[model samples]
Target: MKRGLMIASALALCTAGCGGGASGTAAAAPVPAPTPAPAPSPSPTPTPTPIASYTPAAAAIPTAGIALPLGKCVNMGNHLEAPNEGDWGRAIAEDDFTIIKAAGFTSIRLPVRFSGHAAMAAPFTIDAAFMTRVRHVVDLATAAGLNVIIDMHNYDELMAAPDANAVRFAGLWKQIAATFAAAPATVWFELINEPNTNLTNAKLPAIIAPALAEIRATNPTRPVIIGGEGWSGIGSLATLPMPADPNVVPTFHYYDPFAFTHQGATWVTPTPPLGRVFGGAADIAEIDRNLQTVRDYIARTGRVPFVGEYGANDVAGVPVSERINYYGTITAAYASVGVQSCAWAYTNTFRLRDGDHWIPGMLAAIHTTTTLR
Candidate 1:
């Protein structure tokens, strides 16, 4: 017998043969089994729209003069880059600018997380209050005679889904450019920071051109910085694409001999091993070779390079003296080549300052440029 027929017969027999209560009410008709619903069809994936590419003009505009003012810089990190100003434990204070100026620093690279503070939909508006807050910091830095490089930092969504976010990225820049339009030339823009993942060397030019266009719409001729994929490391620069615009500056970060510079850095996967102290003849030679690679790139491209970030971690396992030696070596090497550099940070990881004062000898280690003093 069929399974359904067998079940029906078994229920019928029980209903007929089983005795009812003394009231003799017939057993209620056996409830029917419910039919299962059909499975849902899967939604189709949306195809990504292709982004337009840029071609540099026959004669590239010179960027060496554009990149000179950012001497002896330092990143004011772990502040506006956080989801909230103080979420990373350091907020930009008014006096912070005064202190930075007193330390002989000529520029401050202010990193802001624009995506986190902006709407993700059409028009992609950055919050007005947050924009104002950023302006306040910029005004404070410039007033103290510090050149401010307002960098678009930590846009995780764009790195993950470039095609989906490109328009929004451009939208955010449209607002940012207009906001700083009237500001002096000392205020600069770094289009995006540490691009990686879906933002490949092949895709970066398409991504940068639109944002650069937006900036030029209002602030033409202002210097804008751009870095390559793979977290802006030296290897990344090998294929970095530049838009035809003359004022764009090429940037890269260095933490070479990574095992030593990033020792005990909890954030890096498998964490670089602890106790990898720096300062050997081989170590010194490696720094020289890397800076030479930068010089070679500059010679080939006429775009003066900026060391946007370079520092060794201040960790429990490494002595302060060794860290200072590494800083002195790296900064002096870049200065020798006339490539301006900004250390990793002021008061966070790889910090030059502690509480209110700079770590002992840390300021002098990086103050290798006579122009900076």
Candidate 2:
């Protein structure tokens, strides 16, 4: 009876914060084990699309340049909340963009997840209304001249039923592509966000290739950024064959040696230990090795490398300066190879460098470029 009471207490507390998720059969996958990437690969096979006749309008130059400027971004976590998707307005105001713009960020990454609507197919339907709420943010970013990258964030079904996953992923993309059919060049369609250890990076191209074909079928030549698996690891991206679309960019994320970045992050079960130290000198060495894997691939493949997300956690003990310094190291590696990048976020989560007050300094650090500086 006493144990039952404690279980009830725990359940009530979890529901209070991030609205309880329905039970998931997906167990956490393997930790990032080091796997040597295979030989320098050829481009992926081309798949046909229905819209073969459609030529993209005068292509808008992608924000990616040989050396991308330090653009800022935030991950938008909530979309369809409360009563309706329309009611799903930003808890923070539009005025926040003023601060963002002033801080010198030129982009935003919107992370949205929706399900249970019919259009996304049998297992998922990220209701059309829900997508509209997300569109509003994209519109706002474009109005502000900030590039927007819209992504399917936190979808769980694929991870649970690996066999049936292809239909679920492909259907979601078809629906999303049809819904956001007219996004401007400045807006990007990211196929998936951090498919990670859950989906072997090997499975990504098969799932994503069909969707890429689907998107181009409607709107030929919109830029698509593909995040790699194994939690979008820099080292792991080397293993996955990047889908080749003349306009597509191979995307990877960084939160490496997570002991430092996610220290004391209570979100995971079996709480990660405190004093989870890393980010001393050796990290740079590891980063260099990782960057080389990417650099070599890009040189071999001629595809642009986009570091879609990179950031440091903001523990009270870890001064924001350290985070900025970390950026200097990672971005420089990207810059050295002429790779473009977008920082992890614009919002202030305990883990991300906060944009609330210190954004100006952070911006100064991130935006430093040989030409711009």
Candidate 3:
């Protein structure tokens, strides 16, 4: 589920033409065949050139790493990332953090649209008022004893024209990193929501590398989350270049079998068909196959994998029971492979709430083995 309206349009052009020449009136003179040229001798194989191996940069804060207990998180979605709080049907009230903390959630993933509040020119400055509002939310969540992930989200302009905005993107992070430099380690920074458009897998590392360096300069020990292209899809994880900093956590968003998870979502183009059900034997197998790849990556590199976002859209037509089953299967699959996950949202779009109360089934599915400390 994306933060704002998505417009997808494709244009294609096709043309065909054929020409025929009239038959020649008289017989044409025959041209003599030229003598064949001798074949060239076979070329010898060139010696193979050895390529230099890539080594990740050593961690500035060697002792900083992801601790397993940071489990069962939820996105405070449809809130700060909007053009304004409450404009998107949800607002970050101080008590919302309390409700989340009381519901057994150990972490909160706060998505902020810094780009909307930033200047379009060089040294792109984030609005002071907006930064203050973000700081207030961070204060509220952190005070509630929840680990917080302040993510850069819904920066469509930047994603569309990354090169033009690379300096501004890094500029925003430098200010943010400095602002939160003194905050506790529980507060984590996510470089960007999902690198796409001009920022393909090959191009993403170049953009992120500078922003990361800026963050390290200010807060060297803080844990930072980074995801791959294709909207950070789990399958794209393998293509993500590992950051030199060891404290970085490679994140992926899972909405496997998109037809099932995003069914009836109005925001999606040609909206996926409705009535798709989940949790069959085949569904479980597919889930396992997807998660196994992440597990394998974790085994190869000691870094733990984080499912930064995962949830099914809550369409009115989809059966509540089916939604619960989908959530349960995904949560269980993550647990089976020791991957940390955060549900897509707390109270918007794919919400777990009705008014101020949580839907018991939805909460139960996400809090599967997690106990509130």
TM-score for each candidate, following the candidate numbering: 0.81, 0.71, 0.81
- Residue pairs with clashing backbones, model 3: 57-244
| Predicted structure 3: lDDT | 0.66
lDDT of 2 at 141: 71
Compared with the true structure, all predictions reach lDDT values of 0.69, 0.51, 0.66
lDDT of 2 by residue, 1-373 (tens): 1111121211221110021000111112111112312222222322321211111121112333222232445444333221223232334456655655665677666665543344444645766566776677677777777777777665555544445677777777777777768877777887776554346677776677777887888768777777665545565555656665666666666655454454333433432344433445556566666656765766666555666666655544455655666665556655555555666554434223343465435655553223321
Q: List the pairs of residues colliding in candidate 1.
A: none
Candidate 3 regions exceeding 4 Å error are 1-68, 367-373
lDDT of 3 by residue, 126-244 (tens): 89999999998999999999999999977776667778778888999999999999998899999987665566778887788889989999999898888777667765667777787
User: What are the runs in model 1 whose C-alpha is more than 4 Å off?
Assistant: 1-65, 368-373
Model 2's alpha-carbon lDDT is 0.51
- Candidate 2: Cα lDDT at 372: 21
In candidate 1, what are the lDDT values of residues 29-86, reduced to their tens digit?
Answer: 1111133123222233223222112121122224444454776789886788776887
